[model samples]
Target: MKKINRREVLKKGVTLGIATTGLTGLMRGRAQPKKLRIGFIALTDCAPAVMAQELGLFKKYGLEVEVAKEASWATTRDHLLSGEITAAHCLFGMPFSVYTGIGGPAGRVLPIAMVFNNNGQAITLSSQDFGGKVGFKDLEGAGKAILAKKKEGKPLTFAMTFPGGTHDLWLRYWLGACGVSPASDVRVIVIPPPQMVANMSVGNMDGFCVGEPWNGVAVKQGIGFTTVASQDIWKHHPEKALVFNNEFFRANPEESQALTKAILEACKWLDNVANRRTAARVIGQRQYVNADPDVIDARLQGVYELGGGLGRRNYTDDYMLFHRGGQTNFPRKSHAIWFLAQYRRWGMLKEKPDYEKIAEAILAQDFYASVAKELKIPLPKDDMQPLGGFIDGVTFDPKDPEGSIKKYKVREL
Candidate 1:
């Protein structure tokens, strides 16, 4: 609740020996970091930033950090542009959109590191539209029912978090793939993740997509059911990352690296499978998601509860492990490319972007690679290349994106 400058925190902490001056001095000399100001939304995925600071990970690296809770993604992006905050726990394709100028205007945002992957994100459907299936039992079947209702002159209404965030894309992609045109066949609306359940209760939206504790809240309220997960759509799909303005990273390279190192360390702790329950409790605290431990704990450990008889069980690839023995946080170039292609597929990008050039500019693979090497983490065979794959039977190749774009059975942007 109290707002203070990053330097002030450092100044106060250093004098009291709460945090060493050595780390601060190193960063100041390296990046001339005036202050390590970072912002985050109230999502569980933003845990690393909170955990890092709370658990002394940042102090260990000599970071005088200012953690601010942002109200919305648009506000967060604006703060990043004006330098109000140095960085943020941001949406996956956010930096790419900022660079391409699609979401707001290109060339305004840059990503420093992918902090985590495969966290809590889901597609929820209202009880009216639940129809008794759970956990992607029949995406096609759901789409067909919605479409049939539309043809009878009743188009199903759906909701997503933001215009360009992953929830929007996933909801659109899933609906489009099921022979339903998201833009045409169904009315896709924008609702904040926190408001998803309340909006569903109004009988306005037949389904919605958002990240957790929101999804779990819907299931608990008995207003909606978990129909699909972002990870389920594409196993191990990239979720959230640490994004910043390019100017920040360019100006404070060492500080950026230091922050990345600190976050990676926090990630390692969170991914230790054994630490899942503890991480959940920490995140569920008022500083982060502010939800009950039960809601936060289950999904963080990949244990799922489907309200509509999909049954309860553990998902092997639900949440991402960013720092587990160093496998979790590697910012692979393929990850960035996949997001770009998805942006193009959704009409966020009009042209067939220069894949390699775009990937190099937005994704900090070189930076990540150096840090990984320094820590003795093995690099993937190809760092700046694309990796192709099939999602729900649709093949996507980053190399031949133009063809891949055309091959999509759904609507093309």
Candidate 2:
């Protein structure tokens, strides 16, 4: 991949030239409908799909898109596989899970269209459990407290959205960093994003890792305090993405490209600081995130109230971003390699899979590059690179994923 200067492209005022009309115009000769049914969970990251629909970007791109709100990540994955929905606002690691048959059936490959956003998800702990002052930096103390509770025959439980999703990875990494074995030292459960607050409110889990609005909602309800934002774990890390079934992508390549272009436009629109307020208001609707607009707006604007007397802070550098200098939307092969490495570390895979082959198979980097080029979006020079500068002072080299995993002492394998 050649590195194209995004600023130069923007300076030229280039638009999604052929993508806006090329595919849809050609499909007009056929009897197929231009309509598409897309699936999304009620989280702030779903903004691109919702905003694309609300702002008429889909229509502008000749796609009649129907945004379906899903109950959970599992349901979204199943719908995509069953062809009920064409694509999804999806977890970054989901396509890999589907490909490896971790949570779903084996021997199926799903395609990731593009990463929708980054740096927004968070880990939240119950304020009641920690007397209102525990966070990632205090994880060692938190771990000892959790162990003490476990010694009393009551094991502490944590929740993530899915078994092999972004939330699961963040929770596992955070726990492991603190010397708490996610598989042994605690009981981990799968909970949907919308259900996280309700479950925690009733004391179902001691802590949870989930996407935005919910984490902010937990704080609003006085149930949990924000331990750390995912960005704090790894700055600008890949979060949610747009994923499609391989069959769907093959059957409707033009339509897929059109959808991607629409969402990409939406992403560019979202990164603007001025649009944060409206974006929060729109995604907060009942048919979408179904949460208080103020709760969503706070984090969307990079304003935080950790709750339970943890204090408030403004984090311009560590907020959720849909497009930060044209970097957030590309689906890097390195990101997939990291996910596979973690799966191997935690015993999700029996052997080290061919990371490059799997990443190339699932992430549609070629298509993304084509669409990006057409839209004049700058492309990174390398598809694989090192992800560094973690809160734990650990570095992940995509070239040596196995070595990266070996460096961790708290993994199952």
Candidate 3:
């Protein structure tokens, strides 16, 4: 008999193990079948999921992943609800929004597996309005432009990707800080991220808040300019998450863990800075963002063109972060409660829903904790860290959700 190499032996053993399951396994720590569908939007932060597939990280963890590019945030949410995608790179607030009945059909059980990234999203205003006159730190100028347009009967429309999504909350907070009522003083509408620039270019909106590459794309087109990045609203704020439908999470515990491990590795790879240019190239491909790699890489590197002749600004401290030694991927329940409080602050909830209850259900800390341990990732001391670093002065206290709501002066409620 011919002697077999160690590599061949290991490969054959793995093949036999998979063949034993035969592409079928029940939930709860059992083997998962191949082609687990994962969804992502065409924004820059989708890099983690894309990279997981491209680098074979998913396969490394015995997960066969199909990274599906979603058309809109709404579509992504629908897919999550329908279980068409087992997991997704999702807005951190979206699962909360759906749970609270503020943005979707309501009572949907999507569990946030981990935070996909933080910061690097932005608020962009049309060149026709505040392009040269306003930039980051010029909310007063943006306010004035809104007033001028209001008097002129244009009323200065604004757009966000989804109601109660991260973009919506940022627009509402920024508008409120500008002394404009999001509910009454200005009309805020919903548009998908990829379509933000196109809508603004045809005189459809005055400003929009969306994820990157879109903001970068706008600058390249000269139709709109970024006023402030989302990090400007709250530096190092959580943006997107690795969210899975709760059914998939609860039923397939071990499979969920393996997939999370894969993405966590991918996130660590992305934060290396040297790989960002390569990431930009891969994610900017036609199947993903379908935008310019140079445009995408510029912002990924903290280099911004700041169009409308606003000049260049490089962010030394806060750019989009995927994994800063595992801090970026930890899904905290406090952040979930913070989003719930935003719904309360804006009176999106008829009566205050149980914030803690909702947060506990939606944020999969226990699941995340198990995966972090396996990967030897350091977890934060607590999930309930006090959130600060706002352009506005108010800090969110997870201990006092209602009190935090009252602190926002421009709130609808």
Candidate 4:
């Protein structure tokens, strides 16, 4: 990796890194770039980028920004690759998938920052099958319910936003816990979040794992009921991030760091409870999620509605996290390890990899740490280590990663 001379960067107000060799360095150092083009699909998860742009966070951080509303995740990925957009509010697994040549680009893709962790995401089941809410206080019960459904000679068809995305992993993990082999027992398909309700209503799918707004719409329309929340499946898992092409980072290191700082500031602003209402309103506008503020606000403020009529008025206090005092964006190697383990377990990665090396190469924890320090955010001595129960009834920790992967009885890689 090329190193940026901090003193020189500070003096010049522009990146003079390894990529800017000779003539290019001499020519471009005279002026700063005017605008940063950011691409985003219209989803509630893209709120931070919207908020950052609306609240002047980008401008406050010395950036001229263009917020490009994209039509699809594929379009956003393409824009990033073609240098049409500087960065994107992208799927968490997108960079990984691209880096490993599993999706999108056939080469490496890098993400500058993780946007948020754990939000209003859920797996919803069609109400055509069950008129009332189905009870599943435990993973065993959920599993049995799926088995019973399968035994009825009708297999469950589920949808996720993108293959290898957070929704995909959560849906797979939840199903795998229920003893339903995602590959065999259930037909898993990739459907954009906005189209989930239409697909379910059209009978193309029986259920779907998706982010908010769509889930809320499905419930409000009485089409389906949410079976479980993502938190219930795996609490506080990393969800989405600001993804970029690796070449973009190589060509613009200073711009990359500046972008990270701008985003980090934006995250802090969003987490302020006082600003949440405004954040919701801004994100709910047509330019962003293009949904009702009430629907968006319900989930943003911890008011959850599990379809078929379930949930407290204010269910979870911290459903979506921005920055947990440096806990939010810093890419922990262990977190990357967990994702890799899941990939292997789900057959996305066909082999047990050199987890440490992959984690180090792709996660960019060191870059995140440096940016955090530059912004004066309090850095945690170690990444978060939470002891929690997974839907599969398996326990996990950083120390016993292999054991954790092996403990899942229903894992089907």
Runs of candidate 2 with Cα error greater than 4 angstroms are: 1-33
lDDT of each: 0.71, 0.84, 0.84, 0.71
TM per candidate: 0.87, 0.92, 0.91, 0.87
Give the per-residue lDDT of model 2 (tens digit) for 101-182. 8878876777998999989888889988875446545767777877777788888999999888999999998888777888
Clashing pairs in 1: 99-107, 100-106, 101-105, 101-106, 118-319, 118-320, 268-323
Encode model 3's per-residue lDDT on 220-275: one tens digit a residue. Answer: 99998888888889998899999997788889887888788778877887787877
How many angstroms is residue 139 displaced in model 4 relative to the true structure, after the best TM-score fit?
Answer: 3.5
Question: Residue 392 deviation, candidate 3, in Å?
Answer: 0.9
Instruction: List candidate 3 segments past 4 Å from native.
Output: 1-33
Native-referenced Cα lDDT, model 2: 0.84
RMSD of each: 5.2, 6.2, 6.7, 8.3
Candidate 3, run of 10 with poorest lDDT = 14-23
Summed backbone clashes in each candidate are 7, 0, 1, 1
Query: Once superposed on the true structure, which residue ranges of model 1 sit more than 4 Å away at CA?
Result: 1-35, 133-135, 382-391
